[model samples]
Target: MTYKLHKLLPAGAAVVAFATMMTNAAADQIVKIGHVGPLTGGSAHLGKDNENGARLAIEEINAKGLTINGQKVTLQLDAQDDAADPRTATQVAQKLVDDKVVAVVGHLNSGASIPASKIYSDAGIVQISPSSTNPAYTRQGFKTTYRVVATDAQQGPALADYAAKGLNVKSVAIVDDSTAYGQGLANEFEKTAKSLGLKVLSHDATNDKAVDFRAILTKIKGENPDAIMYGGMDATGGPFAKQAKQLGLRAKVLAGDGVCTESLAQLAGAAADNVVCSQAGMALEKMAGGAAFSAKYQKRFGHPIEFDAPFTYDAVYIVVDAMKRANSTDAAKILAQIPGTNYNGVIGTTAFDAKGDLQHGVISLYNYKAGKKTLLDVVKM
Candidate 1:
């Protein structure tokens, strides 16, 4: 009986010690990262692209067993749909804050991002927009707001310069969707085009959700301009270009990053060939990590990376990098570390200026040929 008692005592202690070790390891933190975009609207394709980027980053981080401050950490993505509506964006922002997300990587459109920035600022959360290009987003004095792409102030002039020098456009007509993004970009383009001696024939406004642009196009046709700039997404820009073709207007179509997507050819059909657009970053073919990232993105998402997926992908890595530098997952600590980010990413080196905008932003011009977006030139600003 004494021999049996001694053997059982050792075995029980061994089991207790193993269980305690597991308990300690299980205490590792779960860091929540929020992503927002228009998941159920005309822009859903772009939204999904952004979400896929964030998801890929989260999966990679968790699979590698991320460690912060000596604690095994897991990254969780809490994705939300803002419907591309400003009001919806604020509601979604509040939900993410309530859910305790340490950082955010979205609100793809400036119209939605501007309002949501306030909510993130109030909650002391970090927001790094992948595609929002309005200068107002980061110019609002919110240290919590940042973006990976160039603003309209940069992209607008780049496009105008391309049209003036590359396309040699003499007179131009401008049309905007009236959203914050469309109008802001158009305003900037108009200013630059006028400065470059391009005649400003007419400026028109259309709704973001509008289908028929015939009335506006008819008015623009009367102007007989060499180029017509449409400030909107591919959804509208595609049809606008197609309708312009059907109307027998000889003027070429010009647009900003909103209209620059792989799907533009599919949406605009043959008219896409006559369209020229500008993106707020380097072309995917020119990105240092573009080929590998594109292959992985396709294998995982079963689709190609759209407009700003690379930017969002890099945004996730930037946030994680901030966490590593701060040695903490607390939202406040992560926020504090974002401004100091200097990580080299797939998009390029991502470091923010004092206003939380990417300091070394690039603008790439593109044209479509044989149903593909062809890169023209990348202008570093």
Candidate 2:
């Protein structure tokens, strides 16, 4: 009976040890990261691309395991749809703050990012935009706001330079969708175009939701400008180019990063050949890890990237890098470390200026040939 009791005691001790281990494993802390973008509107494809990039990064980080402040951590992605609307963006921003997200990876559009930044700023959480390009976004004096892509200020000049020097256009007509992003980019482009000694024939405004551009195009057709600059997303820019072509308007169509996308060819069809656009970042194929990322992205999402995925992917990793540097998962601690970040990731080295804009921004100019987007030049700013 004594021998049996000793044997049972050892077994019970082992069970107790196993239970303690299980409890420790179950106690792993969860860290939630918010990702916001237009998941149901005209920019849904681009938004999903950004979300998938962050999702892939979060999945990879979790697979490898994360330990901060001596605590094992499991990362979570809290993705929200802003629908590309400014008001919706603010509502979602407050939602993320209330949900206690440690960090946020987006608000893909400049219009969305600008208003949503205040919400994040008030909550003391970090908000990093993967694609927002309006200069006003970073200029609002919010330390919590950051963006991975170049601003419209840089992208606008690059496009205008291409028009003046590359295309050698003498006169240009400009049209904006009137949203913060669209109008801001057009204003910048117009400023630069004028500085370059190009005659500005006309500058027009149209709402982003407008479908028919014939009225605007017809008005511009009479001007017979050498080029037409469109400040809007691919959803509108694609159709605008198509209509211009149908009207027999032979002017080259110039656009900013909003209209530069993989789906632009599909949207604009044969008219895509007549469009020249600028992207706020390096071409995907030209990025340091672009080929590998493209292969992995294709395998994971079963589609080609539209635009901005690589930037979002890099943004997620940058947030994790901050966490590791601070040695803590606390939002405030992570935020403090972001200003000093110099991360080299899938989008090359990323560092921010005083306003949280990319220190070294690259603009890639592209045109479509045979229904494929082709890179024309890369301008470093």
Candidate 3:
């Protein structure tokens, strides 16, 4: 070695040697999984919850030492903030595609998911939406789209049935956040509500970013409906409920999975007691691995689970499972494998129907009492 140093290597030899060493250090094949949601707005908490789910799964997969075709692979998450806006969602979607991510896990709201789906389809990337419940998301005939939860087609009817038959309500008023998730669910619920012999008093529109719902609430209050159905996320839903209580409204607040988050209690405060919500899946206590998953999630994220974390967690596994079946990290191969997804995940047996929707989706009804979500019933569809 002393003699070799005396001979003096070429001027660029040291640089070349350093580059080779760095290359060897990063020899593991990296598979990028993109996660999109509103990480910095009113629904930021819910978006972060979804991101954490994907994060936990990626960490677990990497720790377990994933290998495909004898090549060690490291799972990497490329989380993007869409701010629950469709235009921003498409921008994030295009960025992920340009970055060559193998799969995508989000766009939590149906409004974001539906428009962003086209970008993923054009790029031949697999997109598994965890919380978007609008039926139109999967009905677009894009082979690249899939969802882990039930669609609004099922969720809306279940909520309407509960209101009409379970609560025995005679008349109801509806308010939507004007996003696809809100508007679609409201329309479906309105359809089923009318068919079930309940009088529909009024259906009003509210933007997702509107914090002051006093005007709409006052109008609905005057209608004297037995219940008020809201089709929006917990951000708006919680405030709507709280304001309704403040306005001395006697009508109970009802909503779909958009408002079924655990944070609803905190946001709505005392008004949470009057809020009832529905989720597009079974309650956590009734899920196959819900207890264990929730425990692990809390330990890792330092927070309680939100509504669709389990579904997003399972979505990560589904993407990895498709990769495993294909024995490759190619996006097209993974996309081809998604249609046959029959994974037994934390949410139960997740299988896609002809339209890439969950085949055996279940809807669970929940009510907030003492600032906690209590399960009422699980309706299998």
Candidate 4:
């Protein structure tokens, strides 16, 4: 009987120890954050850049360990691809809401972000866009919608001011891809150009998917405007500039942040030199921690940034910052804390106003020289 009792005691202790291990494992919680972007379309490179930024942040956060409400938590990134389409974006938004993500960071395009904002607002999820810059996005009165980049209202005027003052241009022609972002920026530019006393030669509209701009370029060539402003992404803007150069159109190409990317030189070739563009934030090299972030990013991703990575990277930290301040993983609590955020991150000091827009926005202007993007000026608005 003593021998049997001794054998059973060891088994009983092992079972008790196993139960304790299970309790400890169950104490750790999983917190998911959704990130949506176009991962399969023309803008896939930029979308992937945004996703990678968020992913890197999540990995780092998890490695360092996070505790919320006294419960150990592991961060998970739930990334979705919207293909840069408005309809797809809404679907992706719904999926994230259904997944019950604590927060979301994405829908990079203004067309995608604007429509997706309503769904997120309804779900009470905080949606932070790192690249969407259309003014109407924040003006829709959705308290949940926020962006790290400046709006077209500021970006367009900055580019127009540079064209009129720095380029010394007398007349300009305008072209837009007819999407929400492109047309909105072109409209703002037209308004400011007229205000600056620059002659408006003509304004033309094209679809975002269009590859050939020869017809528009030919028309503008006849008008012989001093410069041409293109409102579209680099996928189309590069081809537009290339076709214009091929047609012997000498007008300098002016574009917004969508066209300002590290890949532009490869797309536009020699014609890249004729392009002047505006990015809706501080230049990467000028960001407070830009150099260090760039090196770390390159080492991790094996490639340079495509323009929006830094913004998105800072966005993840801002979200985590709100989480820390709220002291809880509840989405509502995090959302409530975001409006009062005054985080000094990689992109510089970030604070949002009543409309969820950055309180102090900066636009960086660049001109391509010898097939490379060169900084021209930085304007604070």
lDDT of each: 0.94, 0.94, 0.93, 0.94
Each model's TM-score, in the order given? 0.94, 0.94, 0.94, 0.95
lDDT of 1 at 86: 94
lDDT of 1 by residue, 1-381 (tens): 999999899899999999999998878688899999999989999999999999998998898889998899989999999999999999999999999999999899999999999999999999999999999999898989999999999999999999999999999999999999999999999999999999999999998998899999998888999999999998899999999999999999999999999999998999999999999988889999999999999999888888788888999999999999999999999999999999998998999999999899999999999889999999999
Model 2, range 138-164, lDDT digits (tens) per residue?
Answer: 998899999999889999999999999
Model 1 TM-score on a 0 to 1 scale? 0.94
lDDT by residue (tens digit), candidate 4, 121-236: 99899999999999999999898999999999999999999999999999999999999999999999999999999999999999989988888899999999999999999999
Cα shift from native, residue 136, model 1 (Å): 0.5
Question: Candidate 3 vs candidate 4: which has greater TM-score?
Answer: 4
Clash count list over all predictions: 0, 0, 0, 0
Whole-model lDDT, model 3? 0.93
Q: Tell me model 1's lDDT, rounded to 2 decimals.
A: 0.94
Stretches of candidate 1 above 4 Å error? Answer: 1-27
Clashing pairs in 4: none
Model 1: pairs clashing at backbone N, Cα or C within 3 Å: none
